[model samples]
Target: MTEPANIPSDALTTDVLIRHRREIVDLKQRIKNRRLQVLGLYGTPIVILAALITWAGLKVFVWLHSNTPDAIDNITGFVVFFSGVTFAVQAVAEFSKELSTRRDRKTPVRELKLELSLAEERHVLEARRRTPPPMDRQASYKERLPGEIARLRKESRHYRRIHLFMQWMLFINSAAISAVTAWYDPPQPAKGVLICLGFIVTLITAAAGYFKPRERAFNLQLTADSIEQNATALELGISPYDAVEEKRNLALFATTVEDLRAEQRMREQQLDQPQQGQQGQQEVI
Candidate 1:
């Protein structure tokens, strides 16, 4: 899209950036929804199979302990027959419908992703071209602080959510393994499955430890809070920002904010670094 001839460069760039960003976001959401739909479509059969397997396992356990195996035989047979029929009917209907209509109804995910990437690139270019020189440091800070704080908090929330999800997965997997081992002697297949789950839990634990999302979240939040506090103190003429001269107060505020940001960047770098690198840095420090 071409910018209007009448519009100023900065305004035009800002408008283009905003529009492209919105388009990118919308494209991403659409891609996510389409992927979810595809996953659900393919996953239904696997879920059905898992349920059948679990039911069969339970029945096997019952059969081993109970004398009336024949009593449940008809029920089992009926359930299996019904499940098979349902699976066949649903699969045929859904697969046929999807195969027939998918291409016509939806944009392909790859195309959407390509579109998103192009939009993002356009956004970056527009952003680069639209850099307006700040009239003053205080004005710049006043304009930037709120957006910076919001961005930091949003990122913090995202990382915190991931950390919480991984933690909960670890907890649930650990509990499942413990309950299986302590309460019941499961069959060989179940034991193998438990082993796989334990391996998954270990991998998740290692990932959580390595990436340290919780620590990242904490650092981001701390930095955001510090920045916000300094901004507030500067506004209210409080301690550290209570200097007589307005320029001095603004300079101090800018320095403090910059220092906090630098510290946050350092912390983020440490988190991203390998343990050996971090240890070496610590030794140097």
Candidate 2:
């Protein structure tokens, strides 16, 4: 709950400020990447679906115009076509949200990470005492990091539920379009066309629904190992320096670093609680 105060505002005038600016630039770049991801993930598929549905409609239009004798009266047919489009768009919307969740978060997270590295250094220096514990360096994680992951996983699951519902809505709309258009003109060329397009959308939506996103269980073992390693290294009088500054997968590391800081605060609170209690008991005596 305590606000960060160690880094002086004047430090921003130093090289770290330059790095922070670059990070902000990268944050903007990442936002652009997300925009493109959304477009590709949603726009491309929607366009393809539109094209296929249009193809079916065009065939019907050609047939109706060619042999309608006097007039081409097929209002219900086009209604079915647009209904399919609407349904497809809704499904796309759902999928787009799912894609966004997997890609959002950049600015504040980066700064939080920079702060985390500094905290790790200070933590190591403050813990200097014994022998360093062997840690699995590759898979280090913080407890709070897992909580963030869980929150995202929950969001993904909710998005998937909405996606499934949207898919089902499309399926129902497609079926209705096929049935109604066919009833209006059983021998019409558009009947088979609508039915075929309906089946295709149905298949696509079904496939999309079959795959759902999930979260990983937090690795407590990795967390314990990381903490023990830091503590042991401290015991041997090792100065914490460059290890945690690792920008390798900055997003992941930043979130982990924040979690580590949160864990530290909790530990500090626990340590202070007993002291506070002992002081009160002494005063009573």
Candidate 3:
């Protein structure tokens, strides 16, 4: 076979690469905190405003019935009480946050230095630690292809199961909301709980739509099937791979399999992002 050429001279050492990754993790954690803080500052007021609007609309219903103990009266009273409590809690939290920020500023610089030093020590220790070797040998296409197929199939099953569960939740929540609103005329507390359930269902629906877990599963399965076909053809001396010399063809086949796996991995990482929208949804909860 031909020798591969041109190793890059500017490649980073393993320790430097790992340290960079650790720094990235730390940076992301800081950004996540700042984002959540901003969201909370903005969202609490919007939620309170929504509660007020809901309260006002329900008040008209109560007034029309002349303060009778109907569902609308109970619901209006409930919203007023809860909205007041929510506003109070948010106020207190904001006050506490201000105090905490002041305290953080007053903290000693020496303490900050110590914390930084400890973080560095932890990173160094982690970088020095040795990982266990991979269980499977991947020196050849024959060895690697089956492992890739198994891995892809497992991932597909995982995502498919999650997707199915979310689908069931969406259906069940929709049915429950319909039943409570139409048939039973549930009391105030039950109605409030149902509303929260509806919100949760909306959150789950949003998440499922954003992530497209079923689509991911389908893609993974498709890739696995394609790789399996290629592996089978190579094994059986079928066309394409059959035309090439055995050793060279095996190398080419391995490269193709790895490339496919890499593409799948990149897609998986994109799907895995815990960005602002998901974080905002969690705040709603």
- lDDT agreement with native, every candidate: 0.80, 0.50, 0.68
Each candidate structure's count of clashing pairs:
0, 4, 0
Ranking by lDDT: 1, 3, 2
lDDT of 2 by residue, 1-285 (tens): 233452453343334545655655665666566565455445755665666666567658776466532322354345446656755664555456554354343334455456556655544453343212223232334334455444544554565666666667677778767576767755476766676677767776754534321111123233444544554443343545234533333334444455664664544444345556747755876
Judged by whole-model lDDT over C-alpha atoms, candidate 1 comes out at: 0.80
TM-scores for the candidates? 0.54, 0.26, 0.46
Q: Model 1 segments beyond 4 Å from truth? A: 1-135
Instruction: Residues 149-216, candidate 1: write the lDDT tens digits.
Output: 99999999999999999999999999898877776655555787689879989999999999999999
* Better-scoring candidate (TM-score), 2 or 3: 3
Q: How close is candidate 3 to the true structure, as a TM-score?
A: 0.46
**Candidate achieving higher TM-score, 1 or 2:** 1
Q: Residue 115 in model 2: shift from native, Å?
A: 21
The sequence of per-residue lDDT tens digits that candidate 3 reaches over residues 74-143 is 7655766676676666445556655444222323445545555677666667545532122212233377
Better of 2 and 3 by lDDT: 3
Model 2 scores a C-alpha lDDT of 0.50
